[model samples]
Structure formats: structure tokens, C-alpha cells
Target chain A: MSTDLLTEDQREALQELVNIGMGQAGASIAQVLDEFVKLSIPRISSVAAANLSQEIVRLVGDADVSAIRQAFTTEFRGEAIVIYPEQSMAGLHEVMGYDADTKENKGEILLDIGNILVGACVGGIANLLGMLSAFSAPTLIADQTPAYRLLKPEHIQARVALLVEVYFVLEERDFRCHLIILMPETDILALGQALDRFVDGI
Target chain B: MPLSILVADDSSIARKMLIKALPAHWDITVAQAADGNQALAACRQGNVDVMFLDLTMPDLDGYGVLQAHRDEDLNGLVIVVSADIQEQAQVRVRELGAIAFIQKPVDAGKIERVLKEYGIQL
Candidate 1:
């Protein structure tokens, strides 16, 4: 269970750290859109590799969504997945200041947004926790696919996933996307220890 | 009299970090609220002289609390401490009546500097 992986205090500390990281991510997106972005309180849990698809369906409710994945390594190793509902692209297009002619380039735009958000957020958390990390360029994992069908068979090879979910919304324009950070169980112990050190220092 | 300080954030760790970042030499009484509703309740009871608030929370975020503060004419100086460091968020908080804004992963130096700059006497 997620609770067993980290003590109550460690989990709380990790959640707070994730909050700071997501805030940086929100700020970066806000800058790009030149608007205020609403941020959600981040939620963390551990899911078995086999349950990954079920978990995605649970969070996103089987909607047709566009998803991107960026892998990060070093002390923190895992993938940062950004999922956006298909309908949000129009809003994103308008808010991003892209004209009709450039609408076809929306995929590129999504990848860019994914890159900025994942980089700023994951990077912010790493810095706060004193972990060094490097990120690969983001790739499109799924385009307007059912949430449950988003992940490939090979992606579920990990024994367990440390799932962190945070959402960013541009309320007025009705655009929103979610970021899920998944670290394999192999790194969970290290993360738990880091959280402990962080709490102790505080 | 010791200043009554309230740290309002959904995250317990964030509250702790903010409390730790407070000036060690200052004489103050601290209160904590895990959400903005609790923050407003504390203000209504005249318990908070200065508030360190987070913008994102489970219910009634910092902006909601600030709006209510203005609506109720509540007494307390509000300082927003949040990870949402966008210029718009900052401007919105200022317009909503916050005295200052501090970004998260807050440090002692930043807290002290903001306090000093705002003429908040310890």
C-alpha cells in the first residue's frame, strides 16, 4: 500500500514538496498563456504496474484524451505524463495565440506545453529535495485516445508506480490538463528516505 | 503583546516550513489552518494579526479567503505564500487586499526581507 511505502509524516512532506513543484509548473504555463492558471492540490499514491491503466481510467474517467510523456532520470527516475482532454485543444489554441492556419500544429504546441510543465515542475521538486535530475525530450504517447488505452504494454513493466497527480486549469477559457508523475518502486525507497531527511531538517 | 500569526495552507509541511521560516527573534503567537475556511474563521475570531496564506487548497483557497476578508472587513494583514508565482496570481492577490506575496519553498531570509520591507515591526 502507498501508506506502507512511506510514513504519514514522509507522505505529507512529499505532498508539500510536490505542491511547490507543481506551483512552478503552473507559473511556467501561466507565463506562456499570459493568464492566471488555477492549480489543484496534488494527490500522491502508489499503484501496482498492472493497475496503471485502471488508475488512469479512474482519474480521467474514460475520456478521449491527448497525452505526452517525458522521462526524467538520476536521483529521481520516472516519467512525467501530461494528459489533456481532446476538447481543450481549441481553447488552448486560442489562449496560446495561435491562428487557424497554425491549428494543425497543435500537436507541437501540446508537446511544448508538456515539456515546459514537466521540466519546471519536476525540476522544482528536485531542487527542493536536493536531487539532481535530467529530462528527455517529451514524446506523444497517445493522441485523443481513451484514457484506459493510453499506456502501452511495455510501459507497465515496472513493479509499482509512485503516482502524483496535479491539474492546471485556465478557467475562463475552459482549458485544463493534468500532470501525473510516476516513479517506479525501485526509486520509492530513495524518495521516502529523502522525504525523511527533509522533514528532519525542517 | 505578541503578534498573532496564522499560517493557512492545506499542506501541513508547508505550514511547518513557513513557521520555521519566521524570524526567530520575533515575539509572536502562531496559529495554523489547513484550509482557507479555517483561515477566515480564525480572522473572524480576531485571532490572526498577520496571515501567511496559500492560494491552492482543498476548499476556499487564499483568494476566496481574501475576498471574504474584504467583504467582512476582517482585521488582519494578509501575506500570500504560494507556489503559484505567476504575475497574474501575484497581481490578483494584491488586488484582493494581500499586503505582500511570497513564493513557496520559502526561506527565512525572504520572509524577513518581506517583513522588513513592509515595515512590519517585530
Candidate 2:
């Protein structure tokens, strides 16, 4: 069977839905950080497997990066992404009330932050989809790489990905991040149906 | 009788959500703390029956707070609220003497379940 990729309209609607979700996410993050969080509407696009990394780098710009990722499974399943620019982790730590002196606690701190941010983002999406999503706890990945790097080789080879870039700004700091929602092409139809139900209810 | 509770979380959203999830009928006075230090202070200054402590904080984590007050004769329950779901983390917090472990993005159902399990009438 041929893949049912998102049409332009479907893509636009999904992007808007994701933006609303990210608005809630930004508010949640701001509250944790105790600073105002400014977020862009999130630029949405689709990319083939081979060009995924280059496209992400171009969109986010050249900077040392860290990412918090979580996979969400509804009736439809996909990955959600939240990336941070270099040094923003420190800002996050400050928001959580940690200082440089506590470097030993980085793993715990990073994981906790990732869980909160990614959980909120994915939870918001699940709400929009009108589905209950079961999530695996969030994981933090450092080093600038695309989402595919973390995926199984079989997944990278077979699935076309939907990438949504949600740019976040907190206080005076700027951050470029992306939420990549990827599904097997076979699941696109089911995803579209779910999105339709969600939009109608909203 | 109002049960005084202290809520410690770094995220204002989590705190707000937990407050909202409290049973409206319960006679309760809520005090908020942004981190463990404030939580410790609240425990010292006022009567707190239960504390909802977030595990991850800057100055002192939930574990640190529990350790600090472990020997205190304050009669209250300490429920650790965290996003870390790792079994080891849960086991460690339990070993540290948390009365209960609650994962974050707390909802009404979970709270009700916990209250029921603890035999606390909400």
C-alpha cells in the first residue's frame, strides 16, 4: 500500500494544533524557570530520511545542542522532540534552583527537566488528539544530532518524518528546538482520522 | 478540622495543578514552597500533616529534605512528587522514608487513589 502522507492542509492544521500545545508547554516551562517564556508558532515541515539531519541543522542553526525526547503512543504513535541550545541547560538548572557547584547532580537534574518538559509537550498533544497517551519517561540526549540518530535503523529506513520546530525564548536567552512527530507511513491514515476527530471536538 | 499541607515543587504549574486537584470538600490549609529549603522552613514554622515534595530541586532535593527532617518528631506524612519513574529512584526514595511516591503531572484520580490507599478521608 502506498503511504498517505499529510496534505498541505492537514499539515497546517497539525502545526496549529502543535503550536497550541507548545503554548501550554512554554507556560509550564516558564513557571518552572520563574522567567517569562517566549515561543514561536513552530515551523512545520516534512523530510525524507537521508536529508533529515541536514534539514534540522539548517533550521536550528549551528550551535552546540542538547535535546529532550519522548515517544508518545496514542491509537497512533510518534516521537516528540524538544531541543535546547548550548548553555540553556544551565539556565534550566538555575530555574530549578541549582548552581554550577552541583555538577554531580547533572544526570538527575537533566532527566527531571526532560521529563517535565517532554511530558507537558506530549501530554498537550495527546489532549489535542483526544486520546489517552501512555508515555515512556523522558530521556536527555546531548550532542547535536537529528532525531533519527536515536531511532532504530529499520525505522530510519522506512518512515517519512514530520518535523515541527518550536523555537523557545526564556528571559534574555534564545533557544531553537524542534518537536519531530514521526510515524510509519502506514499509520498516516490512522493519524489523520484521529486528528480529524480531535479537530471536530475542538 | 483543616489539615495543613505543604507543597514543594520547582514548577509552579505542578503546584497549581496539585492545588486544583485537592478535594474541595476537604478542610485544608495549603502552604506552598518553591524548593526543599522553603519546605523545610515550612515544616519548622507551622503544623503540616502532609508534605508533597518534588524530588528535583536546586539547593536541596527531596531526599535531602527528608534526610534533614528524618529525626524530627514532627508528626506528618511525606509524599515524594517527582517525574523520575525509574524503579531505582522510587526504591531509594522509599528507602529514605517517603510515605508515598507520586509521579508528576498529578491528576485528580491519582490523588484520590493515594488518599484512599492511605485511609485519609479527603
Candidate 3:
């Protein structure tokens, strides 16, 4: 049984991989918004499943928010989630070319954006890792409670993930989201092979 | 043959994407490999000038392939084109004799810059 989810090197390499995925995700969202959307420098950390919610809460902050979680399967299976701060919804709508007070279903639009970001990110990761993976439709996790809990079912097998904090910014408005990618079942050899490439000088 | 270039990646989509990013004035024999092992094999066949490689692959991932290249002192220049964009990966690939690192969602500008850095015209 493996004790650690990732070595420093593996985390670094995975971070780099996630960076590209996040970049693609951010780019997709920017395209839809038709504005200069800035993406923050992404970070990857390994926290146990037990502590994942705490980490999520810390990153998510205490704000009214909405979330979209999507489960994906490839050679390894896991989920990709994006949580949005509620205050930014109006700004997003405006940036997306909608009138500020338009009666359009904001939740539906949120899900659509999540779907595009998650799909592009997952596709980029799969394309990089050389594995075929498919992501399920995004599911809303409500606006009142912390959305990370939606991912922590009793049967969840992913022990760790490369946590990417993705923020979309346009001028004065900032929309924050978290892209959590869970690592699936893998033999020790597979894990080691995946990480060994970046161990140099580490 | 003007110059042979090996495009190595696990994803057919990515490989095609890299190929499509090549400039119009470029004239080279573009070889394709689906995994690191095949990438190494391409090097063994010789006369390859540049390799656009991805780090994570099924059999013999990029690091292993790069190590093999180092051990055998392969002549082809390795240009890592991957989604792994960490500085550590970039440094490691450079140490392994890769000449450049281009992150994925690769564009023509990046490709052109790396090609110019290596003195490969067009």
C-alpha cells in the first residue's frame, strides 16, 4: 500500500500538466465571455480525502456560491469541479454579452460554462497523459452550503488530487473557481512511472 | 529529405495539432510516434532532427525515453511539447538533453520561436 499520494517531483509534474489544462479551461471561458479573462498561477497540493473538504472550504472562502462537479473516467477515474462565487454571477452575465438584469436562468448559464471549462480541461489532461477519459455532465451542488462535500461520497476511491485554484478576472470583476482533479487507482509502478520524469534536481 | 522531425505523443489529436502548427515555409519529413518507446525507436532509426515529445505516456513515459536517449547519446534534438509546464519539468528535460520545452495548446508562435532558437529555418 502506498503511504503518500505524491512525491514532490510527481506533484510538480502534475502541477505543470494541470497548468496547461487550467490554461485551456480559462481560455474557453474567456472565449465565451469575449473579454480579457486572466487566469491565476495554478497550484497543486496533495491532501487526504478526509481533509479535502477543509481545504476546499479554505480556498472557497465564506461567500454565497454555486458549484458544478463532473465525474470523469479514463485509465484512471476521478472528478473535476468548478465552484463560482455568487457575487460574480451578475458580472459574468454582463461580460457574456447578456443584459445586466436579463431574466435568463443564471444557474443554467453557470452550468454551461462549467461544462465547457471541465470538458476542455479534462480533454487537455487526457491528451497530455495519453489516456482516453470522458467527463459526465456538470451537476449543481447548490448555493448555500459548501460545494466540495458533493464530491465526498462514501464510495469515493480517489485518495488525492492536484488542487488547482482557477480565477477568472475581467477588469474590476473577479470570479473564482477551484479545479480539483482526483487521482484514481493506480499500481505503484504506474504512479512511479508517471512521476519519475520530473524528479531530476528535486 | 530536407530534414526529418519526429512528433511523439500519445494522443493522435495532439500530434496532429503540433503538425498543423508548423509554418507554411517549412519543409521536413514529419514522422509520428504514439508513445515513448516508439519515440525512442524513431531516434534509433536515425536522421531525425527534432522531436516534439510529451512526458506522460503508457509504455515507457517521456522521462524513460529521454534517459534512453541520453544513455545511447542519440543525435536528434529533443524539443519537449507537453501539457506539463512546470519549471522543474522544463529543467529536467533540459538536463536530459532536450533543447526546448513548449507547453500544450501549442501555437505557431511558440513553435516558431523554438525552431528559430534551434536554428531550424521555417
Candidate 4:
């Protein structure tokens, strides 16, 4: 798939969809944590599949981080990855009201957060686009590892990676995480078609 | 006089969708802004009678725009049009003097109802 899979209008439309999705995601997190979640304008970009690890590095840098991966399928097919720096993992316990003593406790909180974020965010976008998407159980991928190490090019068989960057921050706590929705090259065309239909309907 | 409306959002497609969702029979002149600064610029120029603002934007978010609108004492009535539907977000916008708040994927019927409820006749 070429980098020009989505035209300018389609890209803009998708970005708005991501924004709407992120907003819903933020609301869910705010409700769960009993705090306001500050939202940022979602950034959308596509890169060659082989260069995806580099892109992840660019976003989260080479810091030791923990990540959660959840897969969703429908017209939109991909994994939603949430990356948090290792140092911030402790703050999740205080924010989520979990005891920070046991590794199992930390992992449980991470999975729960991952599920809420991916299900709400991705589900929000899918809903806006009128697509029914199903989410797989979120899994804790790696802890205390660089993000790029988890998302190698060969691991993702897609020719093009559509990255929608949205970060979640709790106003009252020191909790923040970066969300990246990586769709395969084949699905890029499908997503483009879906976006065109959405634009046309408007 | 036609109602001078400004739709400020980073997405061109969202702006278009919002315009499409506006009541067709209302006599209105529309303006566009892609960020908070541009929205503020339009407000400063006295080009906005009713402003539809989005919360999460690039340079300046909608909250900053509303703060500036209050500080600068601009004459435009602001209705926040945003996807960020947190209860706190709504409260903050209202605190900043936005007249109303509308959710994203703009619905025409909702827009009409909001406008009517606010007694904004065009």
C-alpha cells in the first residue's frame, strides 16, 4: 500500500473520527478514575510497515516501558497498543486505587486500563464510521522494555501502518499513556473506503 | 442581518459536517477557523455573532479560546462544539462563558434544538 492510501479529505475525516473516539475514551477513563482526563487533538499519519518500529521509537522514545496490546476486527482491523513508561506504572496504582505491592496487582490494573482505553476508543471510532468491531482480550505484552522492541516491522505483516496518536492524561494524577492504532496495509484501503462513504454521507 | 457564525475545528471535514448540520432555513453567514487563535482572530474582527468551538485543537484549545473571549470581552456568543464530552469539560467551558455544549458527529436536529432553546433566531 502506498503512503497516499487516504486522500487529504479522507485523512482529515479519519482524524476527526479518531478525535471523537478519543473523547469517548477520555470520558470512560475519567469515569473509571474519578478524575478529569485532558484530551489532545489526535495525530494521524501513515508510514511504511517496515518503518513502524522507528515511528514507535519517535513517539515514546527509547525509555523502558510497559505496553498492552488488544486486537480488533471488522472493517477496521488492527491492534491498539498503549505504552506507559516504567516509572509511571507505579502511579497507575494510586490513580486506580490498586495496591502497588504485587506484580500481579500491577498487571491486573494495566490490563484493565488497556481494556477500557482500547474498547472505548476503538469502539467509538468504529461506531462513528457505522462499523461493528469486536475486540479481543487485551494482553500485557512487555514490561520495562523499549516500545520499538515490541513493535518490530517483521512482526506486523502490513505494508502500511496507519498510526493515530492520542495520549491520555488524568488532571489530578501523574498518569499518562500513548495510544497507537496500527492497521494493516490492506485495511488501509478498506478504511479509506469507509472514510469516503462517511464523507459522502455528510 | 444574517447571523454571523464561526465554526472553529482542526478538521475541515468536521467543519463541513457541522455546517451541513446547521438549520438550512436560518439566514446565516458562516466563517471558518482551524484553531483557537484563528477563532480568536475572527472574534476580534467582529465577524462572529455565534461561535461553534471545538475543545481539542492544535495551537490553542477551545478552553483557551473561551478564556480569551472572556478576557478580551469579545461580543460573540460561544457554543462549544466538541467531542470531549467529559462532565468536567462541560463545566469548564460553561465557567469560561460558553452558552452551550454539543457533542461530536454533529446532529442537525440537536443543533436546531440547542439553538431554539437558547432563543438564537437567525
> How displaced is residue B42 in candidate 1, in Å?
1.8
User: lDDT by residue for model 4 over A64-118, one digit each (tens)?
Assistant: 8889999999886889999887766666776678656578878888899889888
iRMSD per model?
0.9, 12.0, 11.9, 0.8
Docking quality tier of model 4: high
Task: DockQ for candidate 4, please give it.
Answer: 0.88
Worst 10 residues of 3 chain B by lDDT: B82-91
TM-score of each: 0.93, 0.54, 0.58, 0.95
Clashing pairs in 3: none
Provide the overall lDDT of each model, using Cα atoms, as 2-decimal numbers.
Answer: 0.85, 0.66, 0.69, 0.87
DockQ of every candidate: 0.82, 0.02, 0.09, 0.88
lDDT of 3 by residue, B1-122 (tens): 57788999876656766787887678888999989888998899887888888876767888898899999999888888866554555678899988888878678898888778878775
Q: How well is each residue in A79-178 modelled by candidate 1, as lDDT tens digits?
A: 8999998877775666667765263577888899999989888887788888788999898888879888887546665777788888888967868888
Candidate 2 lDDT by residue in tens digits, A1-202: 2233776556655655565566566656666665656555456666665566666567555566666667778877776655655555555555567676364455556566566656666677677666787887777765444433543445464456666676666545643345565665555657667666644443
The TM-score between candidate 1 and the true structure equals 0.93
User: Candidate 4 — which residues are off by over 4 angstroms?
Assistant: none
Off by over 4 Å in 1: A1-4, A97-104, A152-154
A-chain TM-score, model 2: 0.81
lDDT of 2 by residue, B56-87 (tens): 56688787988877867556788887654445
Q: In angstroms, give how far residue B112 of model 2 lies from its true place.
A: 33
Question: Candidate 4 at residue A197, lDDT?
Answer: 96
Residue B100, candidate 2: Cα error in Å is 41
